[model samples]
Target chain A: MQRYFIDTAMTAAPGTTVTLTGEIAHHIVRVMRMAPKDKVELVFPHQQAYVAELTQTTPTVAARLIAQLSFNSELPVAVTIACGLSKKDKADWIVQKGTELGAQAFVFFASTYAIAKWDPKKQVKKLERLQKIARDAARQSHRLVVPEVRYQKNVTALCQLPKDQGVVAYEEAAKAGETAQLVQVTQQLKPGQRVIGVFGPEGGFAPQEVTQLNAAGFTTVGLGPRILRAETAPMYYLSALSTILELQTPVVQSAYSE
Target chain B: MQRYFIDTAMTAAPGTTVTLTGEIAHHIVRVMRMAPKDKVELVFPHQQAYVAELTQTTPTVAARLIAQLSFNSELPVAVTIACGLSKKDKADWIVQKGTELGAQAFVFFASTYAIAKWDPKKQVKKLERLQKIARDAARQSHRLVVPEVRYQKNVTALCQLPKDQGVVAYEEAAKAGETAQLVQVTQQLKPGQRVIGVFGPEGGFAPQEVTQLNAAGFTTVGLGPRILRAETAPMYYLSALSTILELQTPVVQSAYSE
Candidate 1:
C-alpha cells in the first residue's frame, strides 16, 4: 500500500481531520489523484502509522484517521550509502534505489575525478530534489523511515555516522587481503547495527583516496571477481548489507524508481 | 591480461605453432589489430594456461608459448541463474552481468506473465547467441567459467530445478521474515556447493508459483528493499555472493578486461 508521511500533530484518535502540506499535498492531491474518502496510510516520524481516508481538499487535503497500530517495514540495519557525485541520471538512480533498499541516509560527495560539477549556489537546491526522490521511494517501498539525503564537500566531510560500522568500497583493496574486507566489516558489525558504506565515481578513487580512508578507519573493500559499473557496485553492497543486518530477504510489493 | 579460451589443442613444449580459429582469430586479427610477435595469453580446457606471442597470420594466426602455468579464476561455488524472459533488454543485461559475476549457468524461462516470446525453431540459435555473449563477457571479466546459456519449456518446467539448492527471487518473500533471505541461503550453502537461483519477469511470479517453489524445496527470497528492474536483482546477488564466498573484496585492475 502507498503510504505518506505526515506530522504527528495532524493525526487524531481513530477519526479526525488533518491537512497535508507542501510537496505531500501537491503529490497526494495533484499527481496521485487522491481525493475525498480514498484510503491511504500516513506515517509520523518515530510513531506508528495510521490508515487515513481523504475527507476534504483546500490549501491542503484533509484526511480522517481510519485505523491505528500496525506493522511497518523497516530494516534491522540502517544503511547509509555515501556516493561520489556523477552524471544526473545516474545520481538520481542511486538515490531512488538506495532509499528503496532501506538506506537511512545518503551522502553525495564531489570528488576529484567527478566530471559533473555543482555550483555552490545551487547545491542545496540540487540536494532537495534528490531528497524528494528519497521521500517518494520510501512511501512506495513501505519503509518506516524516509532516508535523509544531503551533500558533502568531499571525503573529509563524511558525516559522523551513527553506524556501528562503515566501509569504503575501493577495488584496489583486494590485493592486500584474501578476507580483509569481510574481516574488517564483520568485525565492526554486531547484529542489529546500522552500517554505512562509501563508493567512488566512474574514474574510481585515486590511490591517495584509499590511503586517506584507511587513515580515517574506514576499511576499504572490493565487490568480487568482476568489475561492476560504478553505479552498480554500491547498490550491490546495500542489498548484501541489508540482508546481513536484517537477517532476511524482504519481499513486499515491488515499489521503487530508477 | 585478456585471456582467450582455446578450444584447440596445445603441444606440451616451449616452441610450437598454435592456430587461432573462429571469433578469437577474427578478434585478434581485426579487433586488436595485432601483427606478428604480439604477446597474448591462451588457455586450453582443464590444462595449464600460457603466455604466447603471435608468430604468423592471414587465415589462421600462429603463436608460440612463452610461458605455461596452471591457472584458474573459478569461484568455489557454482551458481545457476534462472530469469523470466523479459522484453526491455534486461535479460541480455542479466546474462552479461551474471557471467561477469561468475554465474555458472543461465536459463531464460518463459513464465506465465512473461511478455517476451520466442519461436521454437530459433531457441537454439538464440541460446547460441546468448552463449557467445557469455563467452565475450567471461573474457572481459576474467571469469574461468562461461555460463551455459539455455532455455526452458515454461514455468511448469522451471518449478523442477535440476540442481541442489534452489532460490526464487521474489520481492514478496522478503516481507515474511525480518531477515529470512540471507539466513536461509547462508544456512543452505557450504563451500563448493552448486545452487540455482531464480528471478521473475517485471510482472513477478504468481502466488501459485511461490507455493510451488516452497513445495519443491526452493526458498522464496527478496533481493532487497528496492524494486530492482528485472535485470538488476540477480546481478546484485551474484556480486554479494562473491564477497561472502571469498570472504573479501576482489582486486580491481584495468589489465584484465578485453
Candidate 2:
C-alpha cells in the first residue's frame, strides 16, 4: 500500500476524517490521483499508524479512518551517516539510499576534500530541500522515522555533536584478518544504540582528517577487503549494519534505551 | 604507481618487455604524463606481477620488467552474479561493481519479469559488449580474474547450472529468516565452490517466481531488512556472503565436512 507520514495522533475510530496538506496533499491528490474510498496507510513520527480510506479529494486531500494498525520498520540500531557534502546527483542518491537503509540522521559537512560548495546565502534553504528529499525517501521506503538531514556548515562545528559510538570509515581499516571491522561492529552493537558512520569525499578522507576523527572518539573501520566509492561506502556499511542489527537478530528488548 | 593488466608470460619473469595498450596506455602516457623509467605494477592473469619501468611510449605503450612482485589480490571465494538486465547503463554498473566485489562471472538472463529485451539475433554481440565492459571493470578494479559475461538466454537454462550452491535473492528472504531454506547456505559454502546468485526485476520477484526458483536447485537467501533494489540485492548479498565466508574464516575447512 502507498504510505504517508502525518504528525497527528492516530485514532482507531472509523469514519473520523483526516486531512493531508502541503507536498503530501499534492502527492496524493495530483500525483497519485487517489480517489475517494481508496485505501492508504499513514503514520505519525511515533510508532502509531492508521489505515485510511480517501473520503475527500479537493483543496486538501482527506481520508477517513479504517483502523489503527502499527508495525515497526525502523532499524534496531539508530545509524547516523556523516558524509562530506558531495556533488549533485551523488549526494541525492546517498541520502535516498541511506534513508532506505534506515539511517536515523544524515550530516553533510563541508570538508577540505569536498568538491561541491554551497553558496553561503542559500545553505539553509538547500538543507531544507534536502530534508524534504530525506522525508519523502523515508516515507517511500516505509521507514518509521524520517532520516534527519543536517548541513554541518563546517568540520570544526561538525565536531561538536555528542560522541556516541563512532567509527570513521577509512581505507586504513585492516582487512588482514583482524576480525574484519564489520564483524566486530555487528557483534558489539545492540538494538537502539546509535552509531555515527563517517564517509569521506571522492578523494577519500585525508590521513590528518581521519586523525582528527580518531581524536574525537571515532574508531576507523573498513567495510571489506575491496575499495568502495564514496557514495557506495555509506550505503554498503549502512546496509551491512542494518542487516546484522535489524534483520539478523531476533526481536529483543529495544536497543535504544530512550 | 600506474597499474595495468597484461597477458604476458614474462610478467612472471624477472626482466621482460611488456606493453600496456588502449586506455591504460592513453591514461599513463597522456593523462598522467608519466616519464620514461617510471615504475608501474602490471598483473598477468593466473600468475605473478611485474614491477615494470616505462621504457617506451607514443602511439604504442610498452614497459620493461624490473622485479617480480608477489602482491596478489584475489577473494577467497569465487562468486557469480546473474541478473535480469535493466537499462544499458545499469548493466554496465553491475559489471563494474561485480568486478570490484570480486565476482568470478556474470550472466544477464531473460526472465518473466524483464521488460528490457535485446534482439535474439544480437545476444552474442550485446553480451560481447557487456563482456568488454566487465573486462574494463576488472582491469580498473585491479581484479585478477576478469569475470565472464554471457547471455543466459532464459532463467530455466541459467538455473540449470549444476553448482553446489544456487541462491535466488528474494525480499521474502528477509522476513523468512532462519527458515530451513536459508540457514545452512552460509555454513555449507566453501572457497573455490561456485555459487549462483539470481536477482529479479524492479517490480521484484513474484511469489510464483520464487516457487519456480525453489523448484529449481536454487536456494533463496535473505539480504537483511530493507528492500534492496534489483541491482543492489546481488551486490548486497555478494558482499555479505564474502564477509561471512572469506573475510572471517581463517582457513575455511568447513565444520560440515563429514
**Highest TM-score: which candidate?**
2
lDDT of 2 by residue, A128-223 (tens): 887888888777666778787888866566667874578888855633423355556555666567778888887677778888888887877766
lDDT of 1 by residue, B1-258 (tens): 557887755454667668888888888888888989888877776535788889987767888988875444566678899888887357667787788777899989887778788789888888887888888878776665667888997767877767668878787655544245644564446656778888888778877877887788787776654555577678667756765565542233112110
lDDT of 1: 0.72
The alpha-carbon lDDT assigned to residue A25 of candidate 2 equals 84
Q: Give stretches of model 1 more than 4 Å off.
A: A6-16, A21-35, A56-60, A68-72, A87-89, A112-129, A159-164, A175-177, A190-194, A248-258, B5-17, B21-72, B115-133, B190-193, B222-229, B248-258
TM-score, each model? 0.79, 0.88
Q: Could you say which candidate leads in DockQ? A: 2
What CAPRI grade goes to candidate 2? Answer: acceptable
User: What TM-score does candidate 2 get on C-alpha atoms?
Assistant: 0.88
What lDDT does model 2 reach? 0.72
Task: Summarize candidate 2's per-residue lDDT along B1-258 as a digit string, tens digits.
Answer: 556776645425666777787777888888888878788877787746668898888667778888876544556666778898687777877887777777888888777778788788888888888888877766655566778888877777886876777888887666554333332465466656788888986666668777887898788876665556677777676666656554442222222211
Minimal lDDT window, size 10, model 2 chain A: A249-258
DockQ of 1: 0.24
